[model samples]
Target: MSEPEELPQREQRESTKKKKKTKRSGKKKKEQREGEEQVEFEQEVQSVSECVVLHGIFKLGKKSHDVLLTRTKLTWTPIIPENPTGETGVPQSGEVLLQDIFAVKVKRRRAAGQESGGPVLGVALFWCRRKGRRLEEDTLHLHNASSEHTHTWYNTLKELLTGFSNRPTNLKVFINPSSHKKEAVHIYRDHVAPLFKMADIRTDITVTERKGHVLSVIKECKLDEYDGVVCVGGDGSVAELCHALVLRAQLDADSPEKPVRATLPLGIIPAGSTDVVSCSVHGVRDPVTAALHIVLGHLQQVDMCSFSSHGQLVCFGFSAMFGFGGRSLARAEKKRWMPSSRRREYALVKTLARLRPEDCQLSFLSARKSNSNLFVQRDKDQDQDQDPKSEGEESWVTNQGLYLSISIMSIPCLSPHAPQGLAPNTSLANGSAALIAVGNTSRSEFIKHLKRYSSSTGQFNFSFVETHAVSAVKIRPCSLIGCSEDESEEEGDLKTTPFIHAEGTTFPWNIDGELVEIANEVLIRVHPRLITLYGEEVEEAESSVSCSCI
Candidate 1:
């Protein structure tokens, strides 16, 4: 049965070859027709010439292929050993997209028992490709015919990658191994570093030894050497890096002491407990997503809130809070011994157990007289000079109330806990913050407001909660001697605000995620577009009027 089938198969092959010879003329006419019908871009590309040709092994495979470099891509065709003197067996095994190639470099392997390397020429390429909806990366290692061939290939590819501004060629990376979940280093190794390699970015990485270590290093860094700085940690780490850049710029400016905006854009890879900054910027806490944004050179401007107390600069923060938000963070700090997964829940439970309203004085100046007249008066104000007026001419609204929470956010403040953001309508670089003030309310209602953050339709659904867009705010604690030390903490009993027995009482200020030391009166001002970050543009919808308690 095998012999009979084999004989017919040979006859079929012969008949197919004869048919190919007869149809050769028709095939050429068909090819011409197809070419004429092709897109204009394809017809234009046909005139481009092949740039380079080299023999190399690709992607760690043993067999070598004849690689052809064209203007737009590198195509590899397998060498048919059996038909060496005949036509190539395979048309084209694969092709590498030149635009996707992030890095190209020459490499060498050392000889056995010798200090010197061999005469073999090798090249490595890192490139990205889309797999379904996600971007994937791979490195192709190839052996060129000679050292000159390897150099020529590397130089040509390098030139192309350099021309693409989307890829960052050099970076200073700060990895905090002790951030929230303490997984920054691992995340960088697993997800971020490979992408950088693919993009051919040179990185100087520093695993911070202690808190504020990155700040000190950035202060003394040669700013001209690196393209940007990357923070591989939580919001606190990103904030610290931003602060360093701001301070460095201020020191270099003509007015050394004045607050200066950060010129060097920041790239954040989320690896902490609650990566509010990263989540808000990238819409996710995934490290690879942030890394891709950096490689692609995506830029977004964000405001920074400068805190001043007693006419002295306290610190800079993307977000600030002094009420329940601050209290929950302060409470979370004491439970450091608890497992990370359980720590936040335990702290929230503990803080809620002792929840109460605090009496405070809040004063703020609106950037706009009213939201209704925002765009209507913009051109008129810019066209005419303002009339000179005394400082008293500026209107500031003041309110005294028993408040559950007061949070001022410069960014959207998006996180897993609050996808709509702590302040849902907050703009990223609008030169204002979303100031949310919650009046004294029952515990159940306050909990409901908190729950609304996790939902899209009703974040500010309570009458007790109010949100306003403001440029500046002054907060002063009204009741200083609210609770004593023992009275503040009892099993299942909680205190409203942090108490101090000193001359003036101080309450914890939650700046970003890290808790600040106690302070009495704090003034916060939002600087417009103060810092640039490698982030995608955020489409924010003002949802302040979207929903109300029913």
Candidate 2:
């Protein structure tokens, strides 16, 4: 060994071997750490209830929870402590965390292939409760495997009896399984029920039947006892709720017995076809995110508009319209047979096919000071004495080419889906209204403007469109002086027609995507911001009703 070069060579080889071994060992340790971290994976938990479910186990990441759940069902049995936790094999530590909780954990048999036949994921879960707060986290719970398909957590064991959570809200939920789709129930049970259990929210769920069925339930609700109304449906369901609000307001109008109507925020679950308002307010209508919004919604005032079709309390919104772009909506709805995209395409084609010049007399109170009345009155007194019967069926002909649309908004954006982005900045307390006229020059102009609206990149060119901040507007077309036999009978037709010094009615005015006959006159009184709707959606009508009452 002392013989020089040979000894040096051996030492060099050993040193190199040692380095290689150490590197391999360090790499193995790194791999192990990585696996551990994977077990620790989690989605950002916004729900405090969810955080509680994972109590005393920060070491077990959300992914681990999933893994544990998956193993028991799709793979292996759930992990159990060699010594059981709590009364039912749950660690005593599990009870310690839940000691602060007071919830009702409901258990029911899974419907035939339907899981917890209840609103829960067909697996029983109680809405959770915790003291002293409104917001809650989505939670997780552990269950024991059983031989019977009907076993439930409710009334099954002592631990279930003692370790419950308490909360503030008495919740009542209405789910229209057919709101926009048929799978709404399934979506609610799976994602919503777990959090309900962990947070221990008290809930009563009723599936709806028939159209406007929700309205019927809410009409009879002890509205004060329940803190909020959560509808697991789509816009139509939301519309029903709005109606309920209006009806409640109407009933309470004269009675001092009326409770101070606070804006009861609505919770929407996106289980529908066109969740336009939900998407507009919250961006994407994820069930989880929407549930989060439900927890987060606060009261803010938004504007409302009141209108009458001859005086029968017709409805209008902060955004009012009855013209070209609106007709496109009617057109789009017709192509319901096609996929939404295809329907949109066909609507665009038809709209282009029907653009033409229009003429009419429009009168409104000028935004500027003038020796004028507080209304728009045409100087056409000659028509006062003209034979009313002469202007009949041809009346439709006169108004034909001159389609009109008017929109009144407190802010520039009138509605959540008005070819504009969501969250239309509406003020419910501001009592102002704006009127805009959409003019039809030619098919080319109509096509150009419609395309702009569709792309969400258009602006109002005052050239063809005139906008006025005003109190009232009256429009009458002269092209159809003798169009219909009914029109020839002035006394009969004028009473229900769309125009009158104060009583015209027979015209069809489209209000907020709906059409109503003004069989009489219309004096659109702009009742400044009158109602509170955060994401106004269709609730704009509630304020409209209030203003019309005024």
Candidate 3:
């Protein structure tokens, strides 16, 4: 009886072992089926989402690749050869976004000394790649021996590029030969022209001969023929072009007082000493980047200020400065024989040495408070004390003081000197401008304030510094006799008279890096989204300042 019981126990143990093995095998089979289903589903989804535009085998480097083109991207997978053991290596793929591709051309091999005739080899793709804050040109060669194949790909790519409606097909380019270091022509020829040609953009280039040459040309030229205007120079050239464009637009609309929006966009290639406009707009003073922005159709609508004196329009500009800034620029203009950088430095030093406050009456219409942190935050107590009336009152805020420098900026005015911009609390287009007033302060304190612009914060933290979001501003400079007795004592005796003009008592003004002398009060009114420029909205600038003078 005991032997029979032991045999049944052994058989029961065997039965249990077999059932466990069967269960394990079923699980493995289920996993295999699920993996197969997953692959099938992925393939179906890919097929549904992407419509293959073209597929072919081309050589990338030494290896052949299976190239596939879709509406969104172009992908290439390396084709590995099978070994003698009937095993193939894993394929690696590379891809580029369709939008990144700017141009496609048929690669060719020509005989020595031959300029035009050549045999088609493959297709070459020219694309823009973002490297840090700049856009750089990159090229990829897809080698194929058939001319027909390459031409077909090229035509398809050309058609696709043409579909980008915002991209300019024709551009009117102006290069200021007298710009910083006189390299504008070289910059345009070497760096800018190739990119435009690659994108099949037709450009009518004009190398400016003298001051206001571009303005003269723009005034007479037919603007409708070109998609946009490109200026290759410094802040001054850009400012001039902006003024011309706005003036042209107003003339076209037959309403000089009621200005209209610019019809075409403006592109800036920085080749000047201080490319504040370019740096402010593109966040980098790079010609290649500017060209790429134009090619990619990046547009930024910018606010402009119409400077009017006694009801007559003085000019249209993005930024202007009075007092120290204007004096420095005026001195720099007198020393035209010196290098651009050295002249500016010398002028800065001289101006700082003789820094004197300009007694002026400032009045402005404040912008309504908003949630945007870009605007300067005013002290609640100060705001209430300055204006006791209700918030609904449209009365202008008035302030009278001896200011070292008064700046009104529609753009941030980014440059090597000021990384965050001279007016940090400003935007490209927000229907307002930043009005910054620096009350008379010690030279050391003023230099500290200027140096703070290169830092991340605290540029306007000092008690002497006042910043406001304003829709309009009026600046009226007063003679020395107009200053109060206490204010005059506080400011000390003036070293040099502010009135410099030989013909009349004219005050120097720096408008977008260009010096202008004006007599009497000037009214600056903000025009929102007045002109479209070829750049993306710059949210922040790279914190880097090259100037160490401050």
Q: Note the Cα lDDT for every prediction shown.
A: 0.74, 0.45, 0.83
For model 2, residues 1-550, the per-residue Cα lDDT tens digits are 4679788899999999999999999999999999877665633322322332111111222222222111011111233445454444542222222332333344434667875444332122222233221223433343323324213333332244342222225567888886543778998898766555554456789899887677678777777776566778765565555546655655656533222233455566767654544554444555655554443333344334456544445543444445444455667666666664456557656544443222355555532221122113222222221111222221211122344354544333322233343112222333334565666454455445544533344435436655554445555543433223223333211211221222342444445434444444455544433333433232221011011100
RMSD of 1: 17.3
Cα-based lDDT at residue 172, candidate 2: 72
- Report residue 496 deviation for candidate 3 (angstroms): 14
Superposed model 3: Cα runs more than 4 Å off: 1-49, 82-90, 369-393, 482-504, 540-545
TM-score of each: 0.71, 0.51, 0.83
C-alpha positional error of residue 113 in candidate 1 after TM-score superposition, expressed in Å:
11
Best by TM-score: 3
Q: Which ranges of candidate 1 are over 4 A from the true structure? A: 1-100, 105-125, 129-135, 138-156, 369-393, 480-503, 538-550
Among all windows of 10 consecutive residues in model 1, the one with the lowest summed lDDT is: 379-388
lDDT of 1 by residue, 224-294 (tens): 89888899998888888888888788888865545677868899998987788887777766677688778
Candidate 1: residue 15 lDDT (0-100): 100
**Which clashing pairs does model 3 show?**
none
Q: How accurate is candidate 3 locally (lDDT)?
A: 0.83
